[model samples]
Target: MQIFRQKHLEAVYRRAAEMGPDVARSVELQMLITPKAMGIFKPGIEVIAPVLSTSRKEAKEAVRFIDDSPIRHLASITTPLIPMRTSHMSLVANVTHFPPDVRWCTDNIWIDAPVNNVLPGLKHIADTMPPAPNHSLRLNWQPAASRPDMAFSLESNNYLAVYGAWTRPKYDHKYENWAT
Candidate 1:
């Protein structure tokens, strides 16, 4: 899988580190797959996972799980599926107290396909395999920052609901919906 550190965001990380131990401790190592890698070219389907939260060892285990799963194969029927890649190593701030509470996120793997085509496979995987080791690593299915919609978190059992929400039409926002 392709992996790259976002050199541009390094200053944010460094600033958080300088905020003392509390703020530093709040930083989490996250992994996000690109929309293109997931075969999603649309605006609303990006997904993100906080895979490497606590340590590098945990990150390796999470990476191995993703690499071996059917998740990497959720592309179109005609096109060959692309392998999962590390979009970036995001320093996500878990606490709101921090000034730059950066939340690095993306779309669902099956965003390009119809919900009917995608949900069954995800449901089967969720049923047969164990829940994500760390419950916190669940997928965040959300629209792009430009859209006016609420972001939903998908737990192991709630995969159906998350997929169902995607079928809804986008709505106009009265206020700014700014969780990117």
Candidate 2:
């Protein structure tokens, strides 16, 4: 019977890998394997109570300080077995007693996040100009974190942002795109 249970769990794991994390997480919630006896979700919840408390806060202040934290010291080691961080933090090692790689993509994969991945930016311009003779506009753009050229570019022939009066014809304007 135990062997059959383990096989079922293995099948669930395979389903999680192929179907996605949400489906995998919901796999056979009725039956949970434990040493004491086959129990329900409530006992499992008690096994890692501290992790459940972290949901009270908005920012994840509890997670970063969870390991060796004065309040939830034991929870850091108990988190991995609970399957809470399996979606994103599975590969990111810190307090959990797990490997760098959890062997599956647990979270949404960004195709254009890598340095070599070239994702073309999209920009749009209004067809009809707003009826204003002064041609004044307000811009509320902040400094770019990584690519200044992408956020505030001087070249208009090809760009990821809409070209306005500020960057009209020859890039000559009262203020530079970078606010120089």
Candidate 3:
């Protein structure tokens, strides 16, 4: 994991604080655009998912579960959001880093699951297993966002944290264009 400099973290927090409580509690999950969607990978399609966890250990476990499950085919890639202090308010900061202005919420995993399988899979997962360690896995789904453009405009606009992905072989080629 890349350690964010103190100044950068403070900036993010400062901006987040200005959004107020409703926005902070409302923002959850991170948005993702696949390499193909961004025109980086040929023959790939855009897929999005809520951020499962900021914790590397927990995120890895969720990915492992997906890789070992039948739904693995629906998942394209799992990426990390810029790490932030784990707090409800920080969710606002986390989401400030995506595009397409929108506000809604859902507890269901929102990755690239096909329309046909999404509901059934969500039901099955809800019925069979407890929530993930971070409690990210849930049945009731709601997404929220107010001012998303602030994410791209941040002084340290490194939202995706692509540098920390270097250890994951699957993401190696996908993020070449994002190299600093």
Candidate 4:
């Protein structure tokens, strides 16, 4: 029992020692990107969550004291805004590293996943994602009018293979009806 207690205490001490250096490094990195350091007066929520400050010093200190960074370096430094469709949006996105419990409504989605381990990839996820029973979002696939023929033959056996599909209405689970 004493040995177990000592082992736990040693582990806790080791972790605390490790965290001190890491936190200092994080604070130093924060200093580099601070509004005062960058001479940025404009309200930019891109780095840290926007805090209203009268002076640069306050902004710097506020930034240095930030305990967590849900927003990553990718969205902050370069290509500040990469616009997406209005229907879906997520601020804190680590697509590769999803939360333990990531649930997707699939009333509209006809395909049932065999198991959780054999889940869909980014491309397959769209097919599995549920659309509204009434309002089914569709991406019409018509070749560009300007460049109808760049170099490829527009001949295919499948309708969807050549031309994009018009989305059908989703299924309503509550009503047990296919909404139009």
Candidate 5:
């Protein structure tokens, strides 16, 4: 079984290589094989237990934090398994762990990815988005801790952020035909 799984993964890597180096070079592909294949596992199984006492003020404070977090976004989905840090932490060392590169065309492959992935930035944007009231959240601080001090310094030096603007592009009426 183990050998079959390994061969299957290798075939995937070979296919990815045929598409181009970008797919083969992705961090997700690199961590194909390892004991902790998926990522870090947090064991937190909730069960019936005695209720703990809490003050109204404390509860309100907790609520405030909850109202300002990413957990609210996760609750909208069925199963949420977010990783703290992927390649940065070397969680998946071998690039072959990622899906096989299946090319659809010369310019773009079915699973083409940028040589240097920007998924971390995309995830950061999602986490930083303001949460709605009465929603729950869980802040993952691992990335913050590992980030370089220069990143913080840059905020004061050359800060860059979007404000009072729509993150998405305006809808085009010309695409109405495609909606059908």
Candidate 6:
């Protein structure tokens, strides 16, 4: 169990490094030092969750105070509004990292395993993050006219007349039967 926890923690740090410095620090401080660090020792909920922060100072301090600094060099990098990559298949959503921006791509992403043993060449590419806001949440726009035409409406020659024909005539008693 101890060995496994160590391994999982390492992997989490490795993934943070891949996301870029600010992202890595944010993750380490918010998720690693706060929740996952305790989870490693507690029963259940041993998986690491995503790191989230509205402020940069708290993120920096939390990471700095943590016992083990997996990727301390990441603090020197600048932060961007968007994530480095649009598609980080190696990252998993909400599990490995947080605020939905740092997604967890790999399995067992919650465990605190060292990235060296878990991910291939993760250390080499730790700083090679693609970009921020890796994903776009654009609303799907479709022209109203593009909708498929209704078959019933298209087949009817005189829909308006047919609708009125269903009604009975007021004055003609003989035409009552014709209405039916």
Question: Model 5 Cα displacement at 4 (Å)?
Answer: 8.2
TM-score of each: 0.25, 0.16, 0.22, 0.17, 0.18, 0.20
Tell me the whole-model lDDT of each prediction, alpha carbons only.
0.27, 0.23, 0.29, 0.25, 0.23, 0.28
On a 0 to 100 scale, what is the lDDT of residue 122 in model 1?
A: 38
Cα deviation of 151, candidate 5, in Å: 26
Write candidate 2's Cα lDDT for 39-131 as tens digits: 221111111212333343522333333233333332212343233454554343122222332221111112222212212111011112111
Steric overlap count per candidate = 7, 0, 9, 0, 9, 33
- Provide the global lDDT of candidate 1 against the true structure: 0.27
Q: What digit string (tens of lDDT, one per residue) describes model 3 on residues 1-180?
A: 111121232222232223222232223322221222222332222222223464766655543422343333343343343444558535643442232332222232223333343435323322332111111121112233333676533221112211112223554454333322
Candidate 3: residue pairs that collide: 104-143, 105-141, 105-142, 105-143, 106-141, 106-142, 106-143, 107-140, 107-141
**What range of 10 consecutive residues in model 2 has the weakest lDDT sum?**
131-140
TM-score of 4: 0.17
Better of 1 and 5 by TM-score: 1
1-180, model 1: which lDDT tens digit per residue?
Answer: 322222212222232123212222222222321212123332112233334246665555544433443333442222212223234222222111111422222223323334354445433432332111101112223323354444643222112221111111232131112111
Best by TM-score: 1
Tens-digit lDDT track for model 4 on 72-168? 2212233222223323323322221122333222222222222232222212322322322111221112222354655754522111111111133
Q: For candidate 2, what is the lDDT?
A: 0.23
Clashes by residue pair, model 2 = none
Best by lDDT: 3
Off by over 4 Å in 6: 1-63, 66-109, 121-132, 135-180
> Order of candidates by TM-score, top first?
1, 3, 6, 5, 4, 2
**Two-way TM-score contest, 3 vs 4, winner:** 3
Question: What lDDT is obtained when candidate 4 is compared to the true structure?
Answer: 0.25
Global lDDT of model 5: 0.23
Poorest 10 consecutive residues of model 4 by lDDT?
28-37
